[model samples]
Target: MRLEPDVILANRLADAAGEVIRPYFRQLTSVEAKPDRSPVTAADTAAEEVMRRILKQDRPADGVIGEELGFERLGAGRIWVLDPIDGTRAFIAGRPIFGTLIALVVDGQPVLGVIDQPISGERWIGQIGSWPSTTLNGRRVQVRPCRALAEAHLATTSPMLFSRSGHAAFARIARASRDTILGGDCHNYAMLASGQLDLVMEEGLKVHDWAALVPVVAGAGGVMTDWRGQPLRLGAMGAVLAAGDARVHAEALERI
Candidate 1:
């Protein structure tokens, strides 16, 4: 399939994001608290501002939805979803696994997506329908097959996101999985796309958090959906389940 303009633009968006984020990585300067009690760094706002400026210049009619700066022109058919840093805690803690996410959604479905790790100098790019495979640092990547949950390797941003009563469901999948990784954010999904990881389950995610990763996993021969097997929508339930194998996805969905 041919590459669309949006796919090419997503690359520029990643480049724009990297410029603002790399300087703040491990600097931890002037961290502020949001109403939700989540930490926000100057890098977050700066990176998103770069995206907004570039998009406003290049795709003036397109909409933008950003984690740090909020939304603008969301009703437009084509909207850019931006998450300057998907793992702020890890970023402030000096981890390079945190990533910048950019997704171009067309009519509520993500048509193009990118996960960029500026400090690590790695990126995973994916586009739905335009290509059936994903690219990691320009190298094509695909997910490996895992037929059962018992053989799966799972990853999540954090297990603590689960409530005390919700632990039972999470524990069931944890027991079935061979290993569970904590706190990799979108980088974990990039690993899943590149065949290094088998599954990732997450909760309390916003559109900017998961939109870019959805196409990355789907294009890499993985299945991504909500716990009940529903398609993820903007501002939908935060629960997300993704697996390299469909059978494993089905198996885990039953437990989630």
Candidate 2:
């Protein structure tokens, strides 16, 4: 099926952002540390600017919250959330796992999402009231049904964000799962939506990091929640778990 209108627009912006990011992936002349100590590159700021311009042109009534430009409150019911380059570190390292993230949040709930992985030529999109799917070079895809934790595949972006207890919790969860993949950033969430991955749990995320993913996972017949099984909210950093099935999410969260 063709993508919904909002999703189609998001995909367009994602592709634009991807185009801006591609040339800078491995060609960065320098990297600077932000006040928060996280690294930023020219690619990050440039891609975000491209996306923001597209959004502002097409959806003037909608507000936007972006990693680079901060937030603009349009006071509209719909807001676009953007992470121009989700895995900048991986991109700078010349890895193929980085991507652009975009989502439309209405009434504080994410209703549409798109993740574009340029190197992989993959695009995953989801909208509320529809099943989430991936378009790999433009082909439909769905999440896998891994019903139990013992047979599930797991992934986390980083283990360092977790405290000693958090790390132990992650280790325990990893031991319970059948397999684990690490370090894919937002790409991992796309993998989950495509059924290639089963679960991803992590802590320490911004709205830009998690918002775009919520609709993608949930719309695909999966679940995305905080550790306590609550729906995720923007502007807060906490535990996040994305699972292919609800039962697997419950089981995995128990271990964490």
Candidate 3:
């Protein structure tokens, strides 16, 4: 139907988060560790706070699942998933590759997604509906085709995130692909959607991590799913894969 309002609100949320995060980029001096030992800076918490406040005022009936902050309105059916900074390590290292991920999931399916890199002033928006497409800064983009997995360029945030068994599984895909690059968190998916990269496979992602990626990748003519080749949903496993070409995706799945 008409998703214009939601889309506008999503953009507003990204804009607000970016404003909050920009000030702390390279100036951030302190960081705290979560039980998982992941870094959380004031920037992350502040960015999520601003987005959450805006959502509460603009779409109070909707739910929110944020990385820095916890869940809100879990049963609201229409949820906004937020990852203030998908690449905290990259962000802490003064890298501009980190992104703020915002997603609109309705009934467990992600219908809208935005990957915004404030430092680079780049945004990728994707929507699924009667007409499905992805745009980067208002320009439509599509994934490039790859004839075979041997010719595909692969990327993953890091192999360290995977368990022993998972690492072995990903090693198979890495060996089969043309080349594999490390350290790109959510940016790799954005690159895949924009035809810069071919595939991104990683493990140990949460719902907020992969939810927004589904629409962004799919709308750009790519396929994003769990390691088993199943469509990603609300509660899917953390192991995720995104491939620009379905043929390459299928081939990678077989290897995984």
Candidate 4:
């Protein structure tokens, strides 16, 4: 079956989201706290709205699960999972590390993904199956090789997002790694796909936060799975572990 149309639509969704987000990046005067205490801004809401509108018009049969918006057509065979502004805290701080995450998940598995950093003009696209390579701005990119966890550079969004046990598990992996970066949100995975980072582990991710990352990381020759070493899907637990090298991932999983 042809996937070009789906790929085209995914890019369009990312483009639309970026346009809506750029204006509100640092111009938002107020940030509202969701009941879950996560931050949301006008940019986040507006971006998701625009993407949803486009999907409604162009791919009415596809489902949508978006941050800043609610689920729609959940039982559809294909769903677009969106996190319009993945790093809201960084965006509100005037940082350009935030990104728009778009993923096309068929059934429960993500088959195509896009990560767009609008301010930096960087976009990574990853699609599974026969078209397996990941690309950054149309150029092919792959993960760097790291044979051992001790040689790996690790990263996570925040230690606070981890539970007591999850934090302890991450702490073990961090202690075993060469270094750890504290923040970058979804951008961390993009960097990993570009060979700039080796591993990223985090907890408390929703489906929209991680769905796009699987294809990106996997297409770059990396492995991304839950702490239990199982593949991520629509209903998997939120703990995430990604490594550019399979051996490093296995070692890290053992530690967890």
TM-score of each: 0.96, 0.93, 0.98, 0.98
Local error of candidate 3 at residue 227 (angstroms): 1.1
Residue-wise C-alpha lDDT for candidate 2, range 43-122, written one tens digit per residue: 88988898888888988888999888898984678899888888888988899998888988887877788888887778
Better of 2 and 4 by TM-score: 4
Rank candidates, lDDT, best first. 3, 4, 1, 2
- Tens-digit lDDT track for model 4 on 148-244? 9999999998999999999999999999999999999999999999999999999999999999999999988889999999999999988999999
The runs of at least 3 residues in candidate 1 whose Cα sits more than 4 Å from the true structure, single-residue gaps closed, are 1-3
Instruction: Assess each prediction's global lDDT (C-alpha) against the native.
Output: 0.87, 0.83, 0.92, 0.92
Q: What tens digits encode model 1's per-residue C-alpha lDDT throughout 164-228? A: 64567788899989998888989999999999999998877889989998889898888899878
Clashes of each: 0, 2, 0, 0
lDDT of 3 by residue, 1-256 (tens): 5678988998999999999999998998898999999999999999999999999999989999999889988888899999999999999999999999999999989999999999999999998763348999989998999989999999998899999999998999999899999998999999999999999999999999988888899989899989889988888989998999999999999988
Winner by lDDT: 3
Candidate achieving higher TM-score, 1 or 2: 1
